[model samples]
Target: MFDIARQHLKTPRDLLRFAMSRFTEAGLFFGHGTDNAWDEAAYLIAHTLHLPIDRFDALLDARLLPSELNDALDILERRVSERVPAAYLTREAWLAGHDFYIDERVIVPRSFIAELLPDGLSPWIEHPELVHRALDLCTGSGCLAILLADAYPDAEVDAVDLSTDALDVATLNIERYGLEQRVTPIESDLWAGVAGNRYDLIVSNPPYVDAESVAALPDEYLKEPELALGSGEDGLDATRAILEQATHFLNPFGVLVVEIGHNRDVLEALYPALTFTWLDTSGGDGFVFLLTREDLVTGGL
Candidate 1:
């Protein structure tokens, strides 16, 4: 198949079409960064050609050089055979219009919390400049921590993770964004490393995939670190820990925003007394929830 591609797939359009067909035929999963074969193919192809990924229309008919063609086919073949997320192949993930370096060390950055950052957690945060401290638990590649630094310029954002390898990637991204002084990468089990630190805002996109779902995850998802995906049985272990201990880590009027995946019902059922203000994202409101320090202390989770 690759030989045939090499012989016939000369242009970006030919490669794009061939890739989409191959990806679809392979029954590949598309949850990481892209959700369709077209976008995935375009991204891998664009990256292969060293062209702009988002502006592929101009490059479609342009023929790739011999070397670029080989690289494009190689990456496409890997995407089919390896079943790893494309971000793992390309070592890049974009969230909220910002690119972050990513690898198998961390799950691809697809946090609904990312959608909230641009508005600076408006109304709830009230003033982004007033935010002096922020925390991103399960920081993964420190994507959110970098975003937090961008969102709240005055805030010192701490990016915490259990995996040193993940923290290492986060540190690279922090340096990439030139946020080294503002975003501190800490290796800890959630809030363990930052116990004494209080924050005006805390954001997390923790491991929330349930046991059943994790077992049935696609090969692409399986390629990611399991520790970054599954929590306890109901997928609420990390979320529960965050809720129970968040109030102590937050300032008197601080707010907590979390992306719980599909566990809103499970989380709400577990803590019925807590009034979770579901935040709206492109995926919908149920995936993320917000709570104030008052709500946490009052609900007594």
Candidate 2:
């Protein structure tokens, strides 16, 4: 197939156009068709052949060794064949302005918590005593955990994920940022693994995608862990459990902030009297809210 590059592949962009046309012609769903196909194909090519992006762009359809060229084409064509995500194949994804490793092990970090951190959490953390301890529950790629640690340099941040494979991904991210001393990656099922840990600031972007939604998601999502996406039919299976136990695990003036996502309306309608400060931020509208211990004990406090 190395000889296929010389099969008049045309320009770099044209190659992607050709790839997209072929995938579509085959009636394959290579994601939402949002990203460029040949570009993605190029990424796979560059990765396999160990070529820089610029070099690949400048030398489109350039001759390659039989082995290297076959490898590149195989990777590109496999994505169309498997319907798996390019991110899963590449093991990299960007969130909150940084790239993190990803795979079939954990759910891709798409949590809107990125919008809640940095300058956003400041207003919600008004309590003078709420600065000491913090937790990043259900931390996937350690994305939230790293951000939390970076945000609260004065505080210790605990990052927890249920799957050991997921935790390993988180560990790679932590060490990649030289955060070995700050971010603590703990393997736990929500709060089950924490023995004597209560936090002044507890944030979780747990699995809230409902069963129907899970099944309805695009094929690429199936590459992630099912346990990390859907939490029963109503989707709050984990959230409900988290709400019931989170208060006891919070400091007196502490806060429990969970990202309920687009299902915010359902949660609000179900539990009306709770005091949840729905955060508005730069990234987008949020399902994340700050609920203090008092707020949790009292309605949604």
Candidate 3:
């Protein structure tokens, strides 16, 4: 079947169509860098050709040589057989429209928190201008830290992660964006190595996937490091630690923002007294919550 399909795949558009069909037939997951088969197929086709993604309309009709067609088909076949994310296969991912170098060393950057960084945490932050220091916990690929640096140019951002491999990828991205002066990659388990530092804003997209959920995730997700995905039985082990210790690293008026994914109900039940101000993004509820230092001290443990 693939042989017949490959024979007809002579142009970029033809290859895209063939890939989308194969992806759907293989029941592939698309939540890493794209959400659907069409976009994912386009990404694979365009990136394989070394053409810009946005130029799809202009380049769709371009014919592919025999060798190029074989190479593209091979990648598409491996994507279906391996179940690895297209971003890992392509060695790139984008968050908030910003490009970053990615690999198996880190999880593909897909945090919804990226959508909320442009506004500078407004309404939740009374004085956005006063945000001089910010921290990104479990800063995979350093995408969030880079976004924070871009959003708040004057602020110094510290990105921490336990996995040295993931930190290496983050360092590459930090350097790629020319943000070494503003963003520093620190090797630490949460906040252990960065003690005594206070920040006006603390953000995290920690490993909140529970053990059961982690085990049940698609093969594409399994390609990422399990240390960056699972937290404990309830998936709140890392988040619980962050909530307990975040206040110590926060200034008087500091605020904490975190993305717990679908674990919001568990988190809310765990701490019913604390009012978690969930933020809304383009992708609906977002499952991200904001809390002030006062809220953490007075309401949260």
Which is the leading candidate under TM-score? 1
Candidate 3 per-residue C-alpha lDDT over 71-111 given as tens digits, one digit per residue, 9 for 90 to 100: 88888888999998998988988888899999999988988
Candidate 1 residue-wise lDDT, 24-74, digit = tens = 899999989888999999999898788986678987998678898999999
lDDT to native, each model: 0.90, 0.75, 0.89
What is the per-residue lDDT of model 2 for residues 1-301, given as tens digits with 9 covering 90 to 100?
3246546454444455556665666554443212555556667666666778677767765666656545655666767778777778778776777778888887877767776665677766854344677889889889888877777777778899888988998999999999888788998888898878888888898988887888788777777788788888888888888887887789887877788867888887777888668877543555777788888788743
Worst 10 residues of 3 by lDDT: 120-129
Cα lDDT for residue 93, candidate 2? 72
Each candidate structure's TM-score, on Cα atoms with residue i matched to residue i, is 0.98, 0.82, 0.96
Error of 1 at 144 (Å): 0.2
Backbone clash tally for model 1?
0
RMSD of 1: 1.0
Clash numbers, per candidate: 0, 4, 0
Task: In model 1, state the lDDT of residue 172.
Answer: 95
lDDT of 3: 0.89
| Regions more than 4 Å wrong, model 2 | 1-6, 26-72, 126-130, 281-286
**What TM-score does candidate 2 get on C-alpha atoms?**
0.82
What lDDT does candidate 2 reach at residue 105?
84
